[model samples]
Target chain A: MDNIAGTKSSLTWAVHISVAALVFLWLFPTLGLFVSSFRTADQIATGGWWKSMFPSQQNLTLRASPASEQKLEGSLYVIEGELFEEGIEVEISRWGASSQNISTYAAGEVGEFRSGETVTVQANGSYRIESETEISGSRGKRIFVTAITPPEFTFENYQNVLFDESNREGMAKAFFNTLTVTIPATVLPILIAAFAAYALAWMDFPGRSLLIAAVVALLVVPLQLALIPLLSLHNDITTFLNGLLGLEGANELKGKGYVGVWFAHIGFGLPLAIYLLRNYMVGLPRDIIENARVDGATDFQIFVKIILPLSFPALASFAIFQFLWTWNDLLVSLVFLIDSTGETTVMTKQIVELLGTRGGNWEILATSAFVSIAVPLLVFFAMQRYLVRGLLAGSVK
Target chain B: MHPAFLGLFTILVGVSVCVGYYYFSNQLLDKVLFPAKGPNAGRNINRREMIRPWLFLMPAIFALGLYLAYPVVKTLLLSLSERLPGGASQFVGFDNYTKLFADEKFWEALQNNMLWLLVVPAACTAFGLLIAQLTDRISWGSIAKSLIFMPMAISFVGAAVIWKLVYDARPIDQDQIGVLNALYLLFGGQEPQTWLTIPLANSFFLMLVLIWIQTGFAMVILSAALRGIPEETIEAAIVDGANPFQVFFKIKMPQIAGTIVVVWTTITIVVLKVFDIVFAMTNGQWQTQVLANYMYFQLFTAGDWGVGSASAMIIMLLVTPILVWNVYNARKEMR
Candidate 1:
């Protein structure tokens, strides 16, 4: 279509450039967080994440070996050692003795201290301090260097966010809790909706189209309306069941927990699930089901053996939608699952708390956010074809 | 119990129960209650057929009824009545609505929502159409499309954090970590502006986050609509000396107008119910309060269920037109 009539479109370059700009504009923010997740706090605070990809000039105040290790080398009491730790690749362009003038002398030049001791600092952060008299102070001499360090990144933020047990804000527990909420929330709706969708699509019952219309209406109903009523209902049910079982004082059953959340998700998810599956099943070849009916197979057996297998694509599509929706949901979990104890907090809630408590701590925020985002993103890129198909089928006529 | 173990256990139990119910109910309908071997086999088969659909539909109808249908009615009643002490309520009859109307924050939220409804859908559809057209003929278009689509997979909280970092501000003397501030300073701005703290413009900044996330959705849908346009029509227009812009505007735009409306209304619904971005980023402070977050604040933080239910009803009211339009379209298509 583009190269029709053997003449290329003159706007091709314009198209390419604009698309490139659009993609860049869209990817930049998420990419910023992704890059910042690997950066140390110092690196993130001192420069933009875009700058972290190249060598950056920094004003670092490092300390040399203390005078306690001073040795008498041929009439000079010398305190000699490296200013930076080993394996650090930094080149000092300038050095100084005081914080007031951090770049007074060039690297490898001698600068005299206020007490008349002379220090020679090299570009690689090794320094030699000498004096005719004994160096007496216990502390090391502070060496301020304007150094250029190569690009550096670390996995330590992820370690602290995900693996460190003593870190009170760690996401490990919340990660598992989210998985707990998401898996059942994703799987249960498919089974329930699949059976119902088959009935709606194929079964010739009265009020079938009306039921389909009702499902479509429920599709757009805001779940916000469900919060207060359903929450009170959950509480009432818990109280009633606790009393009925003689477990009132024990309080063995609470309103907010995994089972309650799973039910909520299943209820909220079913409309879309049934809508998508019914739409797909209606399009299934008519002859196959009719032939199976002629062969004396029951509708249940037909659905299980033939329709279920044939509707795999629609099933997979709806599964991905429900999985992503349940995984990335915050409101449902907050309302139905988390209690006052906060023991069952999911990753989204944890990250929101981190935002309030550690607002400026980009390292922790970025890492925790990415941890929550990584699963859906993996599923998205892997199963994007089915997702797009589902969207087209579900939304467009 | 460990959550992971409990999750696995729940899945096993839930799936088996559902499968068991479906299996046993069908068996009961076919064999026990209406056996084919019975003398009245014909009537028995008809009775079984009549009951089987309800058997399959029972769980879904139960869930949808309890979770969705009942809540609308319940929320409406709760909104209309004031709760008294000791688990009782009194009929207040529009008192909550009058109080909500008197509040400045409610009006502010309604105004901001109006602004969102106008801006988010327009921006998303325009950008989506632009990108869909731009990426239609390129070789690497799919990769570009997917990358643009990537943010849709991100949770609103994750997007809030991502955009929060993008809008971060620092003192003027220090290096700016946020790209927006960096660019602002580089362009000779005197001071770093806290972008999210600015009043009305800050709402736009928040809308930008949603726009960023949703444009991919519009693009995918519109791109499909664009592809569905007949090539012969485009070629015919080209042979008739329509320039690229002329061809697109005159020939193509008219064909996919319906899809553009579909994308617009869909995004409009999303923007109306947007909560997490405002909830996570600014928590509806500095006059950035939208309706959904405002309702959350009224309900949870203020513990005023009356006002909260009132606000929820307002949201449902705003969505009512789209709801009707969607159901109407579904019925029309069926006919």
Candidate 2:
């Protein structure tokens, strides 16, 4: 449209800049979490994630080798050691022996301790403490350094959050539990809604339009309204079945498990599932169905053989939608699947619990959150076309 | 058995059962109950056609009815009656509603929800439209749109964690870890603020998380609507000396107004039932309670089913107009 008149608009740069700003504004929060996940606990605590890309100045309290490591050389008893551990490269700009004046001495300058020991610390973190008398304490002497540490990132947080076995807050079990809930929940709804959508679209029946309208109305029905009644219903059914079957105690259905959550997801997902599939199915070329009907193919056969295959895009669309929805859902899983035992917790619930317990522990929180978010994000970016297609089909005319 | 194994087993069984139900029921209609090879073949074929649609629909209907339709009525009834001691309920007309009305917390939640209703949808839609229009002519528009739309996949809890890092606070003496506080201090603020603990502003901060997630949705829908606008109409507008802004505001905007309404109401419905974000972020602390969280608190924490169901009904009531509007549109589209 801008090129139609052979005149370039001056606002083109504005358009680019505004879109860039909008995209940056949208991406910044998730980026912060993603960056924080890789940072160590001390790094996250002392600085913002935005500052993590550059080398940061940090105030560190280091200890020289313990007084027990002191060695007598001629007339002087000397304690010598590196303040930082092996392989850590930091440049100490200033050094001090006391807490009150941490930067009193520059690196490579000697500062006297309260015990009349003189300590000279190098920028490479090697320090020498010399005294005329023997150092007697078992613990190392305290040294404070103002060091400029290089930019550092680590996979240790991910290792601890996902791979560490002894960590009680590990997300490994919860990751599997999320898969357990998500697969059945996503698959069952598509099957059930597919058949229903086929019938609503192709099979001639009284009140077909009404059924479609009902599905449309149900699409916006908040799943919040379903929580209490369905929970009670599940419990009642379990009790009734247990009584009839003469089952009791631990063997009895607790009414909250994978099966209950699956059903809840199916129920919640069906309206949009049916609505999307039926809309797509209705738009399928009309003569194809008529041709199949004339060729002595049953409605079931036609739907299974022709319609299902032809509706691949629509099916893929709904599958991605349902997959993301079920995988990321917290409320339904919390109310239905996870009980007081907390054994069956999904990642989202686990992350929320971590939020409460480990609020200040951003390494754990960010790593755990990113672990849960990783799959959906992959599915989102990989099949975003279908997701957008599904959204447009589901929402817009 | 392990839950993952159980899940795999359930998927196999559920799929086979649905497929088997459709297949066996169709076979029963054809072979046994209404045999097409019989002397009454023609009549049997007609009868089977009449029943097959219902057979195809039966499982979906049962599931939907049990899960959704029945719950709406059940919740409505539970709202009017209080629970008794022994799994029984006594009829108490409007007692729950009255009790809920008298609670200050309920009023706070309702007021905050009203604020959310007023702010979230408008901000999302406006931002969505702006992004959609802005990204339309750019070279990397699709990539920009996809990045913007990426948050739609993140769960509310995940988003809460993300934004929590953004709003994290530290003491005045320490370096601020949260971006908001860091920027606050950088921009000449005296002290870092605990963004989520402040009264009125905290709600908006929470709403920012939602807006961040939902604007993606609104953008995707409205972007499609923008592309759907007729090219000739835009060209005609431009030919008539309509500047770029005028073309978008006067021409393109009018064309996609219906879609904007759809996106708005769709987001409104989402906002109405937004529980996880509030529950995860503040858990109704610091005056950030919304309706869904309030209902969950009533039902689970307080063990007040009557008021919980009442609050659920309030959400349903708010949704009813959109529901009716949608159904009406569907019916009209069918005609």
Candidate 3:
């Protein structure tokens, strides 16, 4: 006993360290995107997200006020100004009058300029150029300064991605489109699966065992096979319905819309939903169901009153799975829901388009990607217990 | 209508339809088709009891048959035919399969998918088991586990963008914006590399995203299995002077071997069906193709339904064994 306890205690520090390392490894990529979304385009382009939190040293070229703004002060033609724009905070580490020697003079050190002029640059990006002769050139003398700028972050990326009406790549409509596809996709399947699961679990049927096996088998079927056939079928049905009803332009009634996606999601989600719900429903104690039945409550009443509440964990679990799957889905919505008009495009498709069109624009890509990721991440954290419980129920057994 | 309103209307219609179907169908079955309160009450009651289960099961069966089972057969048929313009198809009889096999890009996708299959599941399972074991006795285990598991929620496109930033590259003489290039340059590499444009390594880079997402899944399931191990087995091992490694390997590992297989197969299915990551990241360029994306390219981009359906069949072929295995296990469990 002593040896066992000693060994465990000795390994505790190792366990903590390894777990921390794993967590950091997993969280780093997402944290990078999250950080990148908050940063301006210049910051994202000039430095890695890991450097976004700290003051970073940068070499910037700033000019003094233009020659027009130059003034004569005390027997000198002088130009005095801060290198950074107003309200910007930076520490000038080094300064030079020429681009060839950006770091030639130390901060607060005086350096000789062209001819009889001398300039001193302060740490706070303030500088003065004085010469007995007047300053020339329409442009002020170009001053090269190496400065350390504090970390800056903004909500502008999110605004551009989510709200800017002119940005064709904005995720605002795509976000709503995804929600339209997802809610019914998630809810329709659960309601249908719950009723079916109750029958499979508690009610007696001739082929219950076979149905259970079929559900399990269907759980592993790759949905890739469903795409082409389903699309053709939907098209054929839509054309037929249009001709029969003489509703030519109104063919949009069923082929591509929220209802189409809802049905498709139900079709795809049913096997797993039924499998999960039945597994949960089967585990419920037989006595409660039997007592209710003996007291003359119908199966529907029993399902609504007894099993529904009792199976809340299972329902919640499957809801999260379906919700996440539907929310994150690309192929289903791409094939079934979205049309060429691009009005019904979901976030996944929107992000894929951004990846192609605005591939180098990390601000847009990161912000749009994060917007799509945000809802599922929220669902994940909030209903994580049920999600895990569902995984264990679905996979482990 | 506005999509949000349309969505709300769908919820209302879908819910009411489902509720009404079950209620009306059951009512019609019990009260109309075979009324339980009739002169033949006993027979009517027995008949209703028998019919009620099917009524409950009808919608799910219709959905499953139409959505899943029918598509399997339809896709198989489509795979063997040449789809022409204007909704007509000729029975080409395996021409698509031959053409697909002959295409080098299809072969590339197959090879990369093979590499993905061989790597992602093994790496995820190993890392998952490692994390599960390491975090088992720690105080912040759940917090650590949650953080690691958080990526599972993110869409593949989102993950691709996340990793795209990580793999973003700039030429030397400029500050490196991407983390990988930055680290490479910081450690003294000549010229920052374009990570995604490289062939074999790029697939691995993409595989890294899936592995990151799946490892947490493997850990959560395996961790639960590890906890489920009977205390007596470990106590007995400890009493017998077994080391911690011995207890874990000889005792705990064998007990959870079944679950490890389960996790492996589940992740394997995910790897087999992997599309969005490659689609969003590379779209099968630079030898980063997988079958799903290749099929998508064929169907949509290239507009070849026969070849596309054939590739879809190939994915179905890969999944069939798992489907059989799961059904077998389910049958055995039921028995």
Q: Tell me each candidate's TM-score.
A: 0.97, 0.95, 0.97
Candidate 3, residues B1-335: lDDT per residue as tens digits?
Answer: 69899899989988999999998887788778888675898998898899889988999999999999999999999889997787688999989999999999999999999999999999999999999998888878899999988889998888999999889899898888888999998899899999999989999999999999999999999999999999988988988989889988999999999999999999999999999999988888898999999999999899998999999999999988888888888888877
- lDDT, residue A48, model 3: 83
Residue B263 shift from truth in candidate 3, angstroms: 0.3
Candidate 2 lDDT by residue in tens digits, A318-396: 9999999999999999899999988899999999999999899999999999999999999998999899899999993
User: In terms of docking quality, how is candidate 1 classified?
Assistant: high
Query: Per-residue alpha-carbon lDDT of model 1 for A1-397, expressed as tens digits?
Result: 5645446777788889989999999999999999999999988998899988888898888887888999999999998888777898889999899888889999999998877899999999889999999987788888899999888899999999988979677599999999999999999999999999999999999999999999999998999999999999999999888888978554679989998999999999999999999999999999999999999999999999999999999999999999988888999999999999998999999999999999999999999999999999999999999999998888835
Candidate 3 chain A minimal-lDDT segment of 10 residues: A1-10
Better of 1 and 2 by DockQ: 2
User: Cα deviation of B119 in candidate 3 (Å)?
Assistant: 0.8
Best candidate (score: DockQ):
3
How far in Å is the alpha carbon of A310 misplaced in model 1?
1.4
Residue A176 lDDT in model 1? Answer: 94
For residue B27, model 2's alpha carbon misses the true position, in angstroms, by 0.7
Full-model lDDT for every candidate: 0.93, 0.92, 0.89
Q: Please, what are the lDDT tens digits per residue for candidate 3 over residues A149-202?
A: 888899999888877879678589989899988898898899899999999999
Q: After superposing candidate 2, which stretches have Cα over 4 Å from the reference?
A: A1-8, A66-82, A108-120, A126-141
DockQ list for all candidates: 0.80, 0.81, 0.83
- What RMSD does each model have against the real structure? 1.7, 2.2, 1.8
Query: Once model 1 is optimally superposed onto the true structure by TM-score, how far is the C-alpha of residue B225 displaced, in angstroms?
Result: 1.0
